[model samples]
Target: MRRHVAEFPDARVVLNMRSGSWALKLPFLQEVVGHSLRSIYLVRDPRAWIYLMLYNSKPSLYSLKNIPQHLSLIFKDDAVREGCPSVAPEFKTIQSVLSRSEANPALVLAHLWLAHTAAVLRVNEGLPEESYLQVRFEDVVNFPQETAETIHTFLGVPLSPAALNQLLFTTSTNLYNLMYEGDISPTNINMWRQNMPRKDIRLIEDVCGGVMKRLGYTRLAS
Candidate 1:
């Protein structure tokens, strides 16, 4: 931090946070990126995040909390739509691929996503709006240009129109879906719902019922 401050005295650093920070009490942030911090928090729906983590479980920060433990704030209706939105891919083709979870993945994923989201809201609480910024991960996936533009404005950086165009049509992230079978997971950009067993879906619904309905994730149309 001392060197960074000395090198770029007026440089305002923006931390691009996704998940794990809020869920794990942010000890990781304090250790790695806390000093000399101007923060922009990008949050995702814990439920949608569940889908991502289930397939892309990065040990770096993903923690699975199967059961809900009491926290400071009990979530109510109209949860704040932080800057980043979490995406739940309801695309029909993708669902048919990730249908197999060795264990009860639906409920597990739901719990993890919701619990973590709650944690982030708590961590971001009381943080001055300027010092901390919140965004939804989903908004980034579906509307990259708009999302990127928002990010650009937030950080006061120049985002070229060409760069935004490239992000919009990219198929790289589709690899996450089993849309291409030989692949481990479907890549139709999310079909977790279509492929998951009915029971598992029900389980997820039970655990994350409120969020699902509120966020319109209960059912998908082809």
Candidate 2:
């Protein structure tokens, strides 16, 4: 941090991490930076997240036969306990859900989402209100300019007019153009509704309904 500041005093350092247990590293990071760090916690709807996971996992990783082993490896990570003591209890809960004989892929993924989200929310309780900002992924996609302004405001950073214009333009472009003309929609906030099976959707909601409701994602199934 000192080296970066010395080189670019006016610049603000930004770290992008997709880790669910990011809070575990916060105290060490704060110590290194010698100050409290502002954080933007971006959360996506679990259904959408699970859909993407399934889509990206492909034939091998997405196979029902491989799911148990794939998830077992993830949950069995030793660093989970060593890095975040608060999340240790959730390990048993997640394992119990995974161990169910009838558990399906969506159900297992939903439980994983619940465990990670709950862990982050637990850690967030200890943070200063002004230093933390939680933004829903839906809001960011549905309202890009507004979300950008909110983020800049939260970080005490200036949102330049040109930067805002660029963001607006990018949001308006077709996703295909943005990704080398591949066939994809401009917005995919609800694509899970089309791609996921009804049974999978119901299973996800069954395991994640409470948190989903709290996060303002309405359940499509009873």
The prediction achieving the highest lDDT against the true structure is 2
State every prediction's TM-score relative to the real structure.
0.52, 0.75
Q: How does residue 50 of candidate 2 score in lDDT?
A: 80
Question: Residue 83 in candidate 2 has what lDDT?
Answer: 60
For 1-222, candidate 2 gives per-residue lDDT tens digits of: 777765765666566666546665555555455444687788888987788667533452447447667567765654545565433455456677778887766777788788777767765667667777889977865787899999999988899999888776765664333221222333555777887788888888888888788888898944
Clashing pairs in 2: none
User: lDDT of each model, Cα atoms only?
Assistant: 0.48, 0.70
lDDT of 2: 0.70
The list of candidate 2 runs beyond 4 A from truth reads 1-20, 27-36, 55-70, 74-87, 100-102, 176-186
**Top candidate (TM-score):** 2
Residue-level lDDT of model 1, residues 1-222, one tens digit each, is 546756776765454546424433343444444443446666544434455545444441124533222111132222435853232222121223224343344554565555555455555465545445556655666667777898877666799878786666452444333321222222433545554455655555666666455444554332
